[model samples]
Target: MVPKGDLAAVLASLLPAPGSGGLVGADALRCARALGVDGVAVSVTVGSGLNELLWSTPGVSTQLEDLQFTLGEGPGPEVAASGTAVSVPDLVREPVDRWPVLLPEALALGIRAVFCLPLLAGSACLGTMTLQRARPGPLEEMPLADAWIVTHALTAALVQDAGQWAAFAAAEDGSDFYRAAVHQATGMISVQAGVSLAEALIRLRAHAFRHGRPLNEVAEDVVARRVHFRHDDGDGRAPLAGGGTEGP
Candidate 1:
């Protein structure tokens, strides 16, 4: 078990630097490892069922975020949407109905346990901090408490520093911090299908799921005119031209 004193110190030291913006990925990874989790990430909701991944540990953690964004399911999105924490001690033991698609895929990716804590600004949920473990189990009491501390600190940083962290993150490693393509495609689909932006996004996810492609790739295709959505298209599902769904 991690000592609360050590956790407190680590969190204090890693609090978002006003000059450098929010907590850096390295510091986040260090804090997550110290808390005995394999990976962790922070994200904010951009729109209905859309999130902007701010920072995350490398490897499967990053993949998990992408998967959740693509499938529009999982504890991370749940917490971001509802502003309530969602803890899955063991994915295998979880009811398939809870996340019918995300469970099998996440298990295949070696994620055994997951936890999501909301970052709240007053009564509003700004986003969430998602943690993943390779082994199946719940966090110890100390670690769980420390995780909440991390969320509170992150929330404070995001609220106080405003756009500094987001801007800094956008410049790091050429990451698409804002998920521009997803947003762009949603808008296009909204117009093409004559549907609300929320419905357009739902159609985008369904199309991605049907084609077994990543959501962003499909969005990129739509933005590139490789995929077209029409009001008459059944359920707004259309196959990519040339039997492919990737953008050129």
Candidate 2:
């Protein structure tokens, strides 16, 4: 169990420093681990992208999270949309058909239970803090309390990073790092395949989903002229010729 005073100390220590930004990613995971929970992830929505700040477990991958975003469905989206805590204490035993695609994917990755808490300050939502356990069970009260503490810590960090927030928000809506490449690739694919940009984006996502690769990595390949999206067989796929996909 997490002591209230320890939680307070953790929050207080997180408030002021050059290390604050880095601390935001590790603190919750450490707290969860210390309190004997399985894993923790911190995610924030900036513009149209939900960037995962930190992930503490190997079972849930960035690929899985991208699947949620590309498909525009999942517990993360639901929590972000509703600004409410969503807990699925048992993913394997839950109604299988509810999230058709996500449930099976999560279960395949060995995630048995999940908890999400919205990161909010007043009426504004930053994102969500998600906790996952390998075994199916509910999060005890102390961990939940610590999760709330982590949320408030994130809020405080956001308040401190107001200037950075403005800069990030003012940047082009979908132009961050590899996102711009993805958009450009989407446009190119749309023109090539005789489809709309929306369809092109879906196709791009489908390729990434099918191949189990991150969309950003695939987009980088498309941008650098290393690969091309094709629909020769009525399915969109990128077949690379020479070079391997690399980070930007």
Candidate 3:
């Protein structure tokens, strides 16, 4: 069951329905603060090696979320790999090797602590809810539980709401029609590169990140037959037409 908190009400009251350039990340940060975190961010998987920032509290949290996406290592992936909450009371005090790239950078951001809670769909871990604090210390047991509740409720709102259940649940076009081009791009690349769906997404995201572009923009290109993954290494080097796929 989803966490029973005032978040559902808040989401209903504040979030823009479906994809009006609303809900998702903005609401995610709002709900996280309601649960008493200094900052909150949501990371959702679009494919292997691919996840997007669904929402984040303004300021440092948002920057950190972007950092995680760009660096490819952090509590985001740790929680996904471990399938459990990652509580770092004080990043400065922890071993430096633990988060080599992310740690040094996060310290520069004045983030003393973090907690990453998993967002699950049955047995599959879909994403994570990451909260941060300026002061170093572990999250109290009670708020930790609250964080879990919020994670469940938030994932429900982002993924299961309104009968939309594709990988991302919305289209980039913001139209009345739903288009899972991102999801299609993932699968299309999977077959094109002969890799698992997850690995395929990772490749796509890498290309987007290297070029300093958004994943959806890259996905749109793939869907339009402008890009294709011809080799199995997951490189976006394949150039062929009419190899795109669409979602149901």
Candidate 4:
């Protein structure tokens, strides 16, 4: 619960009265500062395995979500499964070995602390809110509580509008392109790679990371008939000469 004294300010920052750009607008980014955190991020994972980033407070938050999706491991997607919040006051000391690829990159990004809050609406787990910091230390009690409040408010906001979530999911904005393209590419790769859609998505992520490209960009190439994956173990994806889907 948010302290009453701070509640109004928090609401003003996150659920700003209309015309202030609303929650999906630039004004909402101020919520992180109001809560005393460096950055905040929001991601929605629909039942169909489609994940979209709703809000990324620029800089670190934006990059962090991208890496998490591309690497396919991190607190963002995992928290929804556990139905609980996960907090890391100090990543350097904790060394989240589970996220081997992410650890080094996160450390390089000057991320010393992180807290992930799961956003749940009714029986459905809507998404997650990720709070980040550049310094090492646990989030102070009040700030953590406020983040939870923000998450709850966000879920309610989305549920209240209802139509917006569908529009948000369908629209290209709000990181929808990446999730949609990844889902589409996964299905295509499944048949060509002789693997399941799950495996194909993973393979796509691996290929993108190895080639040092954005996952979404790689997905676009795959969807554009410019790339094809083989059942072969190495270099799962290869360029398709003449834009051919079938190769000799």
Candidate 5:
């Protein structure tokens, strides 16, 4: 059995650097792994669609969850939408089909169990924190408690960082990584498509999901002018106008 003090210690270790930003994704994933969870993923809803903040210690098919965002279905999306924690102790044994597309894909990828917790600050839902275990078994209560501690820690960190983006050096440290570009691209797509930022982001995720590609890669294409969105297409496709195909 895990001890509450041990969980508290784990959370203590997650404290963000003073005058630095929030905790890093890798750090959070590592912490979850240390607590003995199978996998951890951080997802946030930007505009209408959700984006992956981090997938900690994922399996070979880490991209599967991303597919859910693109397809607009899955445990992560459900948690984000409901602003409540959703736990599927055994994915294969679940009675109802929460995510028809994602469930089958997860089962195929050897992910037998899962737990998803919404990342929220008061009433504002920031995203979801998911844990996946390969074997089927109930999670120890202590671990669940620890998970909540971590989730609240993250929430606090996010709130702190938002008010002070420069508090963390990483926030100031800029990179051309796809995740950052994706945010920029989302803003651009929103303007170009004349759609709400959320809707534009959802469209971006749909395209990424349908094509079996990383959202970051899709965002890169958008930034490079290799891809563009057409609001006229109800199916969320890029028009073949500039050498880009019309499928996600």
Candidate 6:
């Protein structure tokens, strides 16, 4: 439990140093420990269609982010859209209709609880901070307060030096923030299917779902030219361009 006086200090210690600019280092793991969560992730809302992952702890944290991107559902997206924090203390008790696809998959990944906090600048939500717990329980009072403090300070820092972070993100673009192969595959599908990029992404998600495969794996196949999306192909029906079993 963080004392009132120590809260400010805690926030300062967690923030990135001036000119460090981006949130792509060990901060997420450190914050997870401090917040008593198993893992944490921060992602920026890139326009209306994409939420680019900024930094995240390895394994489940990263997988959860990718799952949300693949299915376009989850607490992170909900927080980003509504500018409100989402706390699911127990996924098993959560309504299936709320996240019909994400819930089961996340549970399969061993995530029993989750929380998403909005990074807001004025009325705009710049991004989201997601925390995952392997056990089903609500965040304790102190950790919840600390999470808000960290989120507030982080938001202020990003908003105060918006240009610097923007340049940092642009420089890292595909390599750091966005998944390179997924972005590349989306473009390929857009061209091949004569659909908008947004629609192409939908098709990609649909394909990944139909095959019961990770979106990244499917995108890698597309980028590698193992699979192709022809104009005549419907959703989840990308044919094998090189005569293969499509993808796993």
Candidate that would win on lDDT? 6
TM-score of each: 0.74, 0.72, 0.63, 0.73, 0.70, 0.81
Model 1 has an lDDT value of 0.77
In candidate 5, position 6 carries an lDDT of 45
**TM-score ranking, high to low:** 6, 1, 4, 2, 5, 3
User: How would the candidate models be sorted by lDDT, starting from the highest?
Assistant: 6, 1, 4, 3, 5, 2
lDDT of 4 by residue, 1-248 (tens): 65454446556555434433233543445777867778888888764444677777877888788788887678886787776888888888875676888888888879988899888887678898999989889889888777888889888876786555465445635423435777788888888777777778778877777776667777778888677775555544443211113223
Q: Which stretches of candidate 4 lie over 4 Å from their true place?
A: 1-10, 13-23, 26-28, 47-50, 122-124, 168-178, 187-196, 223-248
- Cand. 2 TM to true fold: 0.72
Per-residue C-alpha lDDT of model 6 across residues 1-248, encoded as one tens digit per residue: 55444444446466455456445423567678888999988888886758888778888999999899888899998998999999999999999999999899999999999999999888999999999999999999999988888788777766775566666657744234347688899899888777888777888878887777778888889998887776663345443221123532
**Inter-residue clash pairs, candidate 2:** none
lDDT of 3 by residue, 1-248 (tens): 65456565545554446556544533655566666668887777655555766667777887787667656789998888767878899998889888787898788888999989899877778888899998888888777877777777776776555544442245435432212566688888888767787667677767665565555667888878687875634445443221333222
Where model 3 places Cα greater than 4 Å from the true spot, the runs are: 1-29, 162-172, 175-248
lDDT of 1 at 41: 82
lDDT of 1 at 15: 48
Q: Model 2: how far is 183 from its true place, Å?
A: 5.1
Q: What is the Å distance of residue 247 in model 3 from its true position?
A: 37
Question: How many clashes does the backbone of model 3 have?
Answer: 4
Give the true-structure RMSD of model 5. Answer: 5.4
- Please report, in order, the local distance difference test score of every candidate based on alpha carbons: 0.77, 0.66, 0.70, 0.73, 0.66, 0.79
| Residue pairs of candidate 5 with colliding backbone atoms | 19-167, 20-167, 20-168, 21-168, 47-198, 48-198
* The best candidate in terms of TM-score: 6
Q: Candidate 2's error at 2, in angstroms?
A: 17
Which digits, one per residue and each the tens of the lDDT, describe model 2 over residues 26-81?
44445557445666666676645445444334336344566576666677787887
Candidate 3 lDDT at 242 equals 19
